[model samples]
Target: MKKVSKVFYITVVLVILAVAFGAAFPDQFEEITGNIKTFVATNFGWYYMLLMSAMVIFSIIIALSPYGKIRLGKDHERPDFSTATWIAMLFSAGMGIGLVFYGAAEPLFHYAVDAPTSEEGTGAAFKEGLSYAYFHWGLHVWAMYAITALALAFFQFRKEEPGLISATLKPLFGNKMNGPLGVLIDVLAVFATVFGVATSLGFGAVQINGGLNHLFGIEIGFTAQFMIILVVTILFLASAWSGLSKGIKYLSNTNMVLAVILLIVVLIVGPTLLILNMFTETFGLYLQHILEMSFRTAPLEGDNRSWLDGWTIFYWAWWISWAPFVGMFIARVSRGRTIREFITGVLIIPTLFVSVWFAAFGTTAGDVQNSGIDLTQYKTELVLFNMFDNLPLSLILSIIAILLIASFFITSADSATFVLGMQSTNGSLTPPNNVKVAWGVAQSAVALILLYVGGLTAIQNTIIIAALPFSFVMILMVIALFKALSKEVKSGK
Candidate 1:
């Protein structure tokens, strides 16, 4: 079994290296991209979207149900963190630089192009925009996280399954995973995690570079990427080596506090009234037209299909890819908690925060644009920087902005590193210091490579392209989750 798992891991690494490096140094990256485009278009296309929608609804029902009351893991002992701290951890680890990266741009992009829901008169685009962000970021994504987390937490902590995606898949594959099947699951999970973390690292480097440029008027190059990666890696490794109590816990708390401060500032300093209105209306629109929006293909009439492919499908795939890491992390933190509580806290609260965040940041940008502010000259990463630039007290606000961006990036890197470690370590259940540090360094390296290859666009394109295989895996996971739950309930376990 060990030999099989090792082979699987080594093979996956080789294949991924071949593909990533092949594309990186290829005669044609476009050809590789074209193949990826074809796969997403044909395979996941509409079925993938519909399946994800079903999974979201089903997971939410489970989250809200009474039978979902079972706590995962054998320990049944509560962790040291309070409810508030746990919430903070969830938000910090799952969100990371997303809020910093998309807060301003997503809402405006939705307003300008309009969400799929907005095509009809029933759902206004702006309102649906926030809802869509919430939906993608919200319960469903967390449900994916929970599926693996719950499995790991319960099995490793309690039932003593190894702390790996393969262990979770064991209930289905049985001892087969002890053979070749186990290797397959773990290998897929590791590759997915590496690329996912790399994507985050790549984006973080670009965003950090952009923030520096905005503040100091410096040109970004290898020097900038290397410096950012080095700093981020060191911070995360230091935190990891310090142990969860000192490092992860401290960083997560800082991240949540800084995040709340940024949100409050945006609410108070930006067009507060407009953001509020957009939030209320947009949420209603999302609720009303969710079914249509979730399944909308926008076939052939326009490249509406392509747009869905780019955003909704792409986001779903990305989330799916990250599930192994995020799920394991959630599992570690969640013990002695009922399934219902875990789901609500993990899935519901974070999603709500994402909605408000998009509304607050994105809608502000839209309002400014609508009122004839030409902030378009600023790139997406720099959108928030530009908005903060307009503040009456620019210097103080800029400093705050820098802190906010740093907090987002560090928290994200830290969490991803921890997760990758947990997954790799055969499910130690609780995070070990060495595992965390190794993942942190690995993630930073990927970020450096992506930066050396190109910029943010290249990273984003890579994530989308890499998402193809994982999309299928995610669909299987959804099915497996439902089956496992049903079996457990029926057996009265």
Candidate 2:
């Protein structure tokens, strides 16, 4: 006989209802979500900042502590994948699409439009912009992910618990996590995963459309973007049908190769000297200002505070929302490693790669913008393509970028389906194909509605709102992890 978890039914209903409402009354839905999103950012901004800071501190302390030697799985069990493959998988599943989408646009925004703390269009703004971009995508983001993955992997692999977020908290809640409360916790993780991945999918779709517009003369609008999502949805669904190891492993490695190739070409043709200079200087600036930027609130100035809400606060919420999916996916692939190795690899490797990545793409965009040509005239998605126009082999670069985005879109969405299926099916590693397919459709549908109703702003609004409840859940998980780790360390396990 077959059994099903209630989480699958409940979340499907909730997502369907929300999608239907948004589809029926998009303007009203958009307005309501926007209001709620604003409310969370304005009221809870300080809480987010404090929590994120704590996450970073905790990750570092754990990696360097005696508990660092604890294996995620049994002491004798070896890693399921090699270090390179493991990194490629985690990095691809972590920030594959985002790095491409924002690599060029974000620093340019801070430099040309409104700088975070400095005046726009100055050398000061240039440094400030890139440094902040590094801060957003660097340690804090990875710390949140590292903690979540460590906790889940520790409990699931070491303690022989089910591979679910709720299971990680049993040290505190005991068997209370086995009842309705546990179901509630799992449901929150599932919803956050659904919305977070959908938001990234929306970004990927828009950027793919933007690339097409630049290369071939296709118009960039809702219709084209929706079709783009539809096509990619079908593609990723097919990948999901193929199951986890074969589909995700191949796609993730492919994503890394294409990404490295694109990165190299951008550096070669676009201001190599300046890119290296910015990489060296801004990496220092990022470290020097880490504490200041991490806890900054801009309480006095209205404009700076608005920028905080838009960028920093929003990113805290974004990474937290994304933590469940990325964290769980990371845990699944990170079996048999010591806690210290896992955290160190997760934190330092991707952070350094992303820093230099921004150096290449972002410094190039800033260089082009400084030449008295405005790159901001294009939409956010189109900014990368427009910047490429100024470099040699512009057409070749655009083609490679489009290919890379599509590949990332498939990998991210495909990895997400497996994670969502596991969450819904009581943490089954091999969740049924039917369940994964259903989740694939659900995520794509949510993305479509978000794009249809309010475009990019809607994606941001929904993610901010989705992340707030999950933030509480994540804090509790951190406490539970500490409690369990302490008991184990005392017992000399």
Candidate 3:
């Protein structure tokens, strides 16, 4: 009989038990998760802000340092994929569904609340809304991803270590990285990745269900959302089985094309001049306030502190939770690229795309609201479809948007399953089929349970709570990576 790896079975069993317990005791689970989430946000919100700012600054410094010239792989090796395909896969894995989910809703929500430093529904409010959207989806999150991916790539390729998160820290912990500590690190990573991806899957299903409800008048409820998860889980499991080169790459490229088409249609059909102006002004505002916004915590805003916890702090935690899956996937595809190239692509390209995406959908939605469209009655998940209702070919565009969401969901899940398999199977670059299938099922099961428990609030709380520990792990990874890089430079690599 083939000997099964202990990490694989241990992680699987632990996750299964946790999900089963949560499902069986839904109220208790929610209470616990909610309390933990609040505690972390209230106490550690400043830590998250400072850590994210440091990550952003660290990534830039590394990219500009002399070590930037070092290739992720061997000295003479070239990139595995072309630039366009690489960027597509990066964006697809990093924040595809999130961009679609928040592009319209977040800006409108910010506008309604009169988000910090602006009055409600005014021109400044619109710009502030887009600026906050940009801040949430901008370079800082990408910097978190880039730093993790860089560490994984450098250790796995340059130093010939296994592609495990703990392996990147061998410089600090030495042989202990191969023992219980390493197993613990990998297990926490598995937990974070599974929950993070499941939360995303749940969010995507909700929006897809909302789109369907708007298009065909289907009732929006748990039944419909579960069905969406079931279908997407099957689709992505098959994609995971097809492996990365065929399934993930193809879906990512297709998603990029569809997203671009939707973007162009919206820009042409909606208020073009308004979107252009908003993009220009918001881009400028984002640049001007990037540093300020990066460190903003509501120390003096009384009850408004909850706003920071919900939006900005929640986003940072969400991104950190997602870093394991996204970072591993990016590392898997990023062999042979230089550190500078990887950081630049991961940080700049996707941030630019997100800015354009937000400017298009966000500004259009803001315009609709300003023109007396009452969007307050709709759920946040349904906001995009509601925005579409006011545009040309509403039905057709809604369907197209639904398809885009589905495609993004599959791509994200597909990559996540592959990464989970790798993390569980001792960092195999190509994890086995059965392992992939197992992760696929596990992810869907968790999403289904969270959906049944408390819908979006449960999912958000789960992500925030789950990401707290992993954020500290990421800080350790940065230190380990820097230590390793210094040695590499001294050795004249």
TM-score for each model: 0.90, 0.99, 0.98
Residues 280-319, candidate 1: write the lDDT tens digits.
8877766777777777776766655666766777777667
lDDT at position 435, candidate 3 = 87
TM-score of 2: 0.99
lDDT of each: 0.68, 0.93, 0.91
Task: Estimate the overall C-alpha local distance difference test score of candidate 1.
Answer: 0.68
Backbone collisions counted per model:
9, 0, 0
For residues 325-413, write the lDDT of model 2, one tens digit per residue.
Answer: 99999999999999999999999999999999998998999999999789999889999999999999999999999999999999999
10 residues in a row with least lDDT, candidate 1 = 1-10
Please provide, for model 3 over 353-421, each residue's C-alpha lDDT reduced to its tens digit, 9 standing for 90 to 100.
899999999999988998898875689889999999999988888988999999999999999998988
Cα miss at 221, model 2 (Å)?
1.6
RMSD of each: 3.2, 1.0, 1.3
Where is model 2 more than 4 Å wrong at Cα? Answer: none
Question: For model 3, how many clashes?
Answer: 0
